[model samples]
Target: MKLVSLITAFSLISGLVEAGNERKFTTIQPDLTEIRKAQATAQPYEFKEEYVPGKVFDRFYNIWLENTDYDKAAGEPHMKDLRKKGITLTNYWAVTHPSQPNYLASVAGDYFGLDHDEFVRMPANVTTLANLLDAKGISWGEYQEHSPYPGFQGFNFSNQETYANDYVRKHNPLVLMDVITSDETQLSKIKNFTDFEHDLEAKKLPQWSFITPNMTNDGHDSTIKVAGTWSKNFLEPLLKNDYFTEKTLVVLTFDENETYEEPNRVLAILLGDIPEDLKGTEDDTFYDHYSLISTVQENWDLPKLGRNDCGANVFKIIADKTGYENIKVDMDGVYNNKSVEGWFSDKHIPLPPPHCCE
Candidate 1:
């Protein structure tokens, strides 16, 4: 009876109860028609070119480290290894005040005036990179360490005795987006780190992956050295594995800087299957979190989001792939004037039009 009860509970949780004695799995693949309907409602934007020949990458992986300054990361041992094996962006800066905005900007092109890390929910109609990737049939998923389960909606999960945050919702940006959380099928893709190892071993990695280490490993409640060592241990083997490296690109970056007074510069490295000639080189082009969005779109021949992505610089490696010339942007002209001042305040206003090519 206990066994039967456990099975019944799982069936209810999965919405796949057995009919009579035979069990049948329900089809929960993403609804293409619904995706198209939602995408049609988004504001249209044009790509710079009508067509691009081939995609630069077969897979994309992003690993976001926590609040780390550019100077500190330069001295870390793992970062040194990355510098030797990959290209580093010397002039990369975080877009806004805090962690949440930077994460949101990476996927949504605009932070939408977010100045704080409060628990705010995005409206369902707002289009995100997930929508764009799904529209093109490109697979995407987020792997968050210490998360309770796929589609867990809690704000924070902590170990009982220590009271230290293991998984914080603020760090996992996809759960805040309604488009991903509204559907069980989409939400299931936002899984814990254990599933990541399983999927990797099974060769079921998605085309685009957003990975966030737990608070300790991500340096939220720890030091950059801890995060760096954790990253080295976790990523070194994957970097050496041909199964994971072939035609794959992995970006390692921090969420924001520690001090608000200094310019929001963070360390960013492009590793994994980097072009032979460009390896161990540095690109000083000015870029922020939005560049991640632009680079992905450029690589996959997808349309721009028309937010900061329109004005953002694509990664030089991707530019080399698409056969396009790289252009530098005047960072001084860009401003963050859309949010009210306060750590917990929620008064967010719309940003002015982007100054593309200015």
Candidate 2:
């Protein structure tokens, strides 16, 4: 059968677990002796290579916060402090409701209409931003806070003691794409915070990365203030570290807004090597998750995913490098509060096919 027909057939079966949104395994139990042993014995993954100079920044990293409205995040003290140290993206919009789709969009260029947080393994042929990065010999990795082990395939993992939401697969961008997860070499790149510390100290960090905080720290189960303070504490010393901040562009952004009644605007900041005059400035460029992909592609002269990323705006900080013009979105009748029907949506539409042939 064809890929589309196979997907359609899987969709029709209620009990079968062929692919998209199926529970192959339950959540990981960190307290179990065997599980603890596995986690302890798992080797940490690292990616280090010669710096591939980009048009502007040499290193690109993004830290995603939880559901937060633009105004709420802007008013927070720590967020304001971070804003003063970087360029604030005032017109950044998330693609849809909930967090999973937006996270997936950051790497995949499209979400395949994912509307909720669930265990999903896209077909192997789907290409991602990582693929583009690899084509240029640019190393990449994912830092997942509180994940039980390196390249963990579980759907979710709670804080063993408090039983709070710790690390969820939904917030992980690279795990959603089978192209990366199915390959052991690529999968090993997803490591925990301990590995992050080791890599940071050893200077084995990759040029490109997506960092996801645990639920409480990201404000998914708490408040935006928690996320902001954690973000500030996490990034403050890195700014002073020469190795970490050298030609690095770090973005502190949210997955989506807390309110579904308003436009899906979220606060995003660009941090790294800002001049005295440009610091604390605001860029009202219309941007979304896909913009990050386009910005990276333009900076590194990489191939486009040929999805929403192809037309997304490049960041103004490096617009001079690409000479690409960005437009301010007229928000008169624009509303992205709701997600359009797609494969994972409640009433599924079959337009956006899984890129099994990419």
Best-fitting candidate, measured by TM-score? 2
What is the C-alpha local distance difference test score of candidate 2? Answer: 0.83
Residue-level lDDT tens digits of model 1 in 1-358: 3423543463354333222322122222234354345434432111122222237887888999988889998789878887888899998888777788778778877666466776766667667887888888777889988766666666777655687888878888788788778987788788778778887786777888899998999888899899989989988899888888888889999988887767788899999989788888999988778888878888887776666677567888888757766666555634332332221232222233433433
Worst 10 residues of 1 by lDDT: 43-52
* Steric overlap count per candidate: 0, 0
lDDT of 2 by residue, 1-358 (tens): 2533553564455233333542232443345676678776777666757889998899999999999999999999999999999999999989887788999889988776676776666677779999999999999999999988888877788888998889998999898888998888898999888888999999888999999999999999999889999999999999998889998999899999999898889999999777668899999888899999999998999988877786678999888657977755566755666654455543224435433223
Candidate 2 error regions (>4 Å): 1-34, 346-358
Worst 10 residues of 2 by lDDT: 14-23
Q: Over 4 Å off in model 1, which ranges?
A: 1-54, 331-358
lDDT of model 2 at residue 141? Answer: 91
Q: Candidate 2 clashing pairs?
A: none
Q: What are the Cα lDDT values of the candidates?
A: 0.73, 0.83
